[model samples]
Target: MSEGGIPTIDIEDFPAQMGKLREACEKWGCFRLVNHKIPLTLMSWIEMGVECREIIKVYAKAVHGVGMEIAGKLAESLGIISSSGESEEIFRDWACQFRINKYNFTPETVGLSGVQMHTDSGFLTILQDDENNGGLEVMDNSTGEFLSVEPLPGSLVVNLGDMAAVWSNGRVSNVKHRVQCKKGEVRASIASFVLGPKERVEAPTQLVDSEHPRYMRL
Candidate 1:
């Protein structure tokens, strides 16, 4: 269920591993997922030329599906629909943003931060990190220490963001992560963000009570 202390969730196991998924969100705030079904070719930059835009289009569309799928599972893990029998549509009309990051690392930049530590602002982030370059790190909420996130081939990393924390009424953790320069190489990553649902986001009535009150509103 974990690789090097980082949670590893196999999406192929789905609802059966719902508890693990929820635990990953609550405890690790992020997880590396396998069997996501995205092709390896699309995970690359596609030569970084004239077809860059076209590749992005294809890649975005594919990652978008995975993003929505994860969003739905997260809601289900929260017992949103099963508890109320009401069709939860927190991801309905959600926005997907695609980003391709390129980091130029050098000897002088080694041991430096490629990006500052911060929590994502959206609901979830599906990241295809560089298979050859490993620099991403996530904080271990329990100890307040950052742990290196080693790249797992053919797997994608999912990070719970601020929106997830708000939607789950503090049940989920908004992870803090950063990218450091580990080597002098060109590091690239593709990320698909599942953002606002175009509707007010709030915890389900079932999650809010005298025992467990809502912690945030969006």
Candidate 2:
């Protein structure tokens, strides 16, 4: 890990990262990665950050109470059913505000309280943390335990969300996670979620036989 606990993984090793992603989806629901190559300069750019924030705000505003509209779109994009039935609203809730947390420690500014343990709304998430300070942790559902994750420079942590688990029919798990403030270190992180298109049906598909069906459909 670098000064900020960030891990850097080479893009050339994307296949290996994909394998880890598949494993996280099937078992842990979350995983730490190194060397995912989303540049630090780009990650720290205020203008780019503002643009991203605006896009999220617009999406949240448009899909506020009309979940069906969002569901329809997601279904269409994923090639699923158009109507979500009872699950339409669930997808709507998935479209929420974007959050960016930057931590700094000082006499005037103490570190921030990390987020509580919870699952996200959308299907997938990509997070980039400050490479030096450590703050992320994930619960191992199977073991009923939590594990600390040190930030790796140039790496991105990818996680599946509750929607994905539901769509996969439980085959994929949406892991629970939280962040804890490091005693004296400063930290920062950027997280982005993938949303469903409007008018798309939300449900799991059958990927296997009755003995082992797929958890959820994309």
Best by TM-score: 1
lDDT of model number 2:
0.55
Residues 1-218 of candidate 1: C-alpha lDDT, one tens digit per residue: 12366788888896687899999999989999898888987776632754577777888899888887787788778887662123335566877788878898988999999999999999999998888888999999888888999988789999999988888899999999999999899888887898766777788787898988888788
lDDT of all predictions: 0.84, 0.55
RMSD of 2: 8.5
Clashing pairs in 1: none
Those runs of model 1 whose alpha carbons end farther than 4 Å from true positions after fitting are 1-3, 46-50, 83-88
Error of 2 at 143 (Å): 1.2
Please give, for residues 144-215, the per-residue lDDT of candidate 2 as tens digits. Answer: 676777766655676667877767566667878887776565566666666554444345453345875654
Cα RMSDs, all models? 2.8, 8.5
Candidate with the greatest lDDT versus the true structure? 1
